[model samples]
Target: MFGLIGHSTSFEEARAKARSLGFDEFADGDLDMWCSAPPQLVEHVEVTSRTGKVIKGAYIDSVFVPEMLRRFKTAKRKVLKAMELVQRSGIDITALGGFTSIIFEDLNLLREERISAVQLDWQRFTTGNTHTAWVICQQVERNAPKLGIDLARAKVAVVGASGDIGSAVCRWLQRTGVGELLLVARRPQPLVALQESLGEGRILPLEEALPEADVVVWVASLPQSLTIDTDSLKRPCLMIDGGYPKNLDTKAAAAGIHVLKGGIVEFWQDIGWQMMELAEMAVPERQMFACFAEAMLLDFEDIHTNFSWGRNNINLAAMDLIGEASLRHGFKSLGLEPASSSSPALSIA
Candidate 1:
């Protein structure tokens, strides 16, 4: 079984949980955690490729913003508690999901005396961002044509190109073929290093690159809203909103830009019953975000290694491997709706 740590973006989303916990009220940074045994699987789901792959798990919600995670004490407490909960629930591997992975990126609880005393293997914990990048690339490729932008000859701009997701997207775009890639981020050195390492893209500030881009992907970190002169983008540009809080300005969509949020994938089968309940959301049956799917796929493959970790670690080979596995397991890039052909979403397999 695989486990995941998640978080809510608003206090309203967790208000009931807080009340159930006997609290009079809930604040923005409040945390919640729970475990699910042998997750709910639909009957027909057994006929799919993921057939015998049973996933039971636990999740934690550490409300939004990095300010709450600035102190090491908070991260350590939440990380350790979440780990203990998953371990005690009989989960074999626990994947850090959402901001939980970002806030606790380099934290090693196994090295701490408290966890060392328990003798749990830290290797069982993996960051789900690897497969996320893979799916993002697939989504881009699948949707590019529908958006009327040909990636092979389009000027692509990646916001937050220095971040884990943005960097990986850049690497994949470089390999997949693009007319030009504009790397954008606040940090210059890492952007320069990444540009030099990739040896393909040109490093430019977000402002300078925005007007020249035909395809814009927003993956910047929190508090840094993606501020671009959308009117200056090449005519009929493709904009992908791939950030956690959704960086794209929705107004741009009304102005005729094609925008698709990151982490969304189309599943060929109905395995969403239990997964939806676990997430506590009313997601559509066939659609799932790739980050959550990563843990489920890893559990199905029975590969317990720390597959993806650290910043800027996602590469072409790993992305391809995971992409292939996801395809084999009934996950496709067929967009959110079957009428996706008429929509901005791409129908990829």
Candidate 2:
């Protein structure tokens, strides 16, 4: 069975989920874990290249961020408990979704924690960032033209460039021929290493990187809101806000900047089961963050290895593999919500 570890995006959502899970009352920090009913794929979803692979799995609610993430100890405990739950439920591979993936940047810490709790092999875990990068790249390619920006000549800046998803995104943009690339992160060392390997791009601190970018990819691993003054970016910028807790202030988008919720793909086919019933979670339009989709697609491919682990190690081959697997599984972003040039900023508050 496959397992997805995630947290509610808001307190209200958390309470609703808890009640549905049979909890009379669930406070902000309470965690809940439950198994999904066998996901019955409809004809449209089942006729994909995978023929008909039905995935049986479980999902964990890591709860909202403020309590779980306020301190490392609390976050670590919650993650360990979730891992234990997945292991006990006999899930072969568990995808660490949303904020849970970011709590421990050093996978070794997570590894030790896993061993302490379940003694399972590290290969049983993955962050699923490869599919996330695939979705982000696809969004950029699909939306750039409409935004009147030529990616071939656009100045693209990737915040949190040293992280897994951000680095993969940089690689994808380079392959697509972005004219200028700027890598932004807290430190310069990792950025330097990435630039040396890619043979291009300039590395700058976060503050210095914003004003010059035509298309800003804010995909940082920050636990809290980023401290950038949104007003600094060049106007008419296309900002792909890919952070889990979301790093960009919506006010920036309110001032006429184009912002697209990144790392998510919406399924347009007539899937017989609603996402809420399938996963027992609240998500709009059967759309899921690419990170979570990675697990489902990998299950279809029977690729049980640690497909995406650690930071900054995702190569183009892995990205391509997940992308293809997604398509074969009948996953398409075609009619899903495209990042609108006139849409309001996302509310992370």
Number of the predicted model whose lDDT against the real structure is largest: 2
TM-score, predicted candidate 2 vs. hidden true structure: 0.81
For candidate 2, give the lDDT of residue 349. 17
User: In model 2, what is the error at residue 125, expressed in angstroms?
Assistant: 1.9
Clashing pairs in 1: none
What is the Cα-based lDDT of residue 91 in candidate 1?
Answer: 67
Q: Model 2: residues >4 Å from true position, as ranges?
A: 10-12, 25-51, 111-117, 221-232, 247-249, 270-285, 333-349
Q: What is the TM-score of each candidate against the true structure?
A: 0.80, 0.81
lDDT of 1 by residue, 205-286 (tens): 7678877888877787535543456667667776677776654554354455666666666565555344344344324455
Which parts of model 1 have CA positions greater than 4 angstroms off?
17-54, 58-67, 70-72, 106-117, 222-226, 247-251, 272-286, 334-349
lDDT to native, each model: 0.64, 0.67
Cα RMSD, each candidate: 5.4, 5.5
